[model samples]
Structure formats: structure tokens, C-alpha cells
Target: MANNSLLEIKRSLEPHVGAKVLLRANGGRRKTIERTGVLEETYPSVFIVKLDQEQHAFKRVSYSYADILTESVEVTVCNDEGQVRIEYLQQ
Candidate 1:
């Protein structure tokens, strides 16, 4: 995408900075950024997501806007303490 387009998309996504977001990888599976907010970074122009809790299964990850195509996303929460669960919701 072009810089102007990215900027526009970034501006539209600004409100979601402090909001929860679901990241979908190349596979069909998805990951959730818990309790944290969104952050903009320069190196790759992606969203920096912080982890609210210590995710035993996965670490904190940054999500690129390009990777997240839709507002509707799936959230997965799992840990050694409990069972793994999944949720699908709209952003």
C-alpha cells in the first residue's frame, strides 16, 4: 500500500490503539492481545500489542494492519492453568 493510504488507514485505526485486537496469522488460527492496548511503530508500521498477563503459551506480538484485514476477529485465550477457549467478535 501507498504511504498516503497507510496514513489514512492508520488514522482510522487510531481509536483502536487502546482497544483489544485479534491477530490472525498465515494459518487459520488466531491470537489475542489481552488487557493491553494498541501502539504504532515505525520500523514496519505495525501495531505494537502489549500483554496484560504473562501468556505461558505465547509471547507479546506486534500485528501489522495489513495482516489484519477485517474488523471481525477471533480471540483465543489459553494457559497452563486452564483450558483453551476461543471467541469471535467484532471490533
Candidate 2:
């Protein structure tokens, strides 16, 4: 499933809490910032990621599902089995 709608996207990510994920977010001027973290929590409007201390300056970041819908941020879940990289689309 592409997880197009915001509710669908949230539902899709709900099971992956506490898993490792790589986030690529646009920082402006074509800059893409990468961060690896644990999937902390998911709420009605946004989801939180706890950043790895070794690689990032800030501790944790929260992003809205809308960001995913707009393609401003990308999330890739890393697991022992494999990586789950799904592209989200807006309904």
C-alpha cells in the first residue's frame, strides 16, 4: 500500500514504533538533512523520532504527516529483516 491519505500513512507507521528509521528532510535551498533515529511515537497529527546521539546535534524531532504527503520529508525504516521505504501520496 502507498499509504496515500494522512490517516493511512499514520496507520501504516503505527506498527513500527521503536524501530530504527532514517529521515531525510529538506532544509531549504535544495539542502537535504539526514538523520537516523528510533521511531518514538505517533499521534493524531504528528509523529516523533528520537535521534541518535552520535550523529545528530538535536535530540528528537517531530514531524507532521502532512510533511510526508507534501514530499518534504522521507522516512525509511531499518530492521533486521529489511528496510521499509514507502512513498506517501496525498488523497
Candidate 3:
């Protein structure tokens, strides 16, 4: 089990979805993929995700490269009206 709380992970990954993500493909290839969406369909692992420019959704298994890629994720949770600030990240 991961030491981090699910809420924390969920909160961190929320706003970052549909944002650009750097993916390390097979054979050391690196490409940028825009995160289409996130789905916590199952617990403990498996956050459903859809890729930008694609329709099919994929299950991004937790703790894998997919998850690690979000390690650098930056999210900003704002209040209604898009004026009042709520939360955000610097790194």
C-alpha cells in the first residue's frame, strides 16, 4: 500500500487532467501526451484516464510510469467565479 493518502493523490491529480504530460515510451522514447481525463473507478489502484486526441479511455495503473509521470503535476484549485484562490502548487 502507498504511504500517501488517496485523497491527497486524488486532489493532486484532479486539475492536472487534460494537461500536458511527459511520457517515457518504450525504448527510451519521450513524447508529450495531454491528459484527457481521470477516473477513480476502482480503489487502491487503477485511475482511469483518457488520452487527448483519442477517444478510448485507459486504466492508468497506480505506482507505474503513468502515475510517476504525475509526480511533477501542478494543480490549482480555485473558488467559484474564478477569482478567489483556494489552493495551488509551485513545483
How high is the CA lDDT of each candidate model? 0.44, 0.89, 0.37
Positional deviation of residue 70's Cα in model 1 after best superposition, in angstroms: 10
Write the residue-wise lDDT of candidate 1 on 1-91 in tens digits: 4555545555555544454443434443465433432233323366566554544343456655444444333233333455222321233
Ranking by TM-score: 2, 1, 3
What tens-digit string does per-residue lDDT give for candidate 2 at 1-91?
3334888889888999999999999999989999999999999999999999998899999999888888898999999999998467533
TM-score of each: 0.43, 0.90, 0.33
| Location of the lowest summed lDDT over 10 successive residues in candidate 3 | 82-91
Model 2 residue 51 lDDT score: 100
> Which prediction has more favorable TM-score, 2 or 3?
2
Error of 2 at 89 (Å): 4.3
Which has the better TM-score: candidate 1, or candidate 2?
2
Better of 1 and 3 by lDDT: 1
- TM-score, candidate number 2: 0.90
lDDT of 2: 0.89
Residue-level lDDT tens digits of model 3 in 1-91: 2434444555555554444333322322464333433332334443433344454365352333224434433222233445221123223
Which whole-number lDDT from 0 to 100 does residue 34 have in model 3? Answer: 37
Highest-scoring model, TM-score = 2
Please tell me which predicted candidate would have the highest lDDT against the true structure: 2
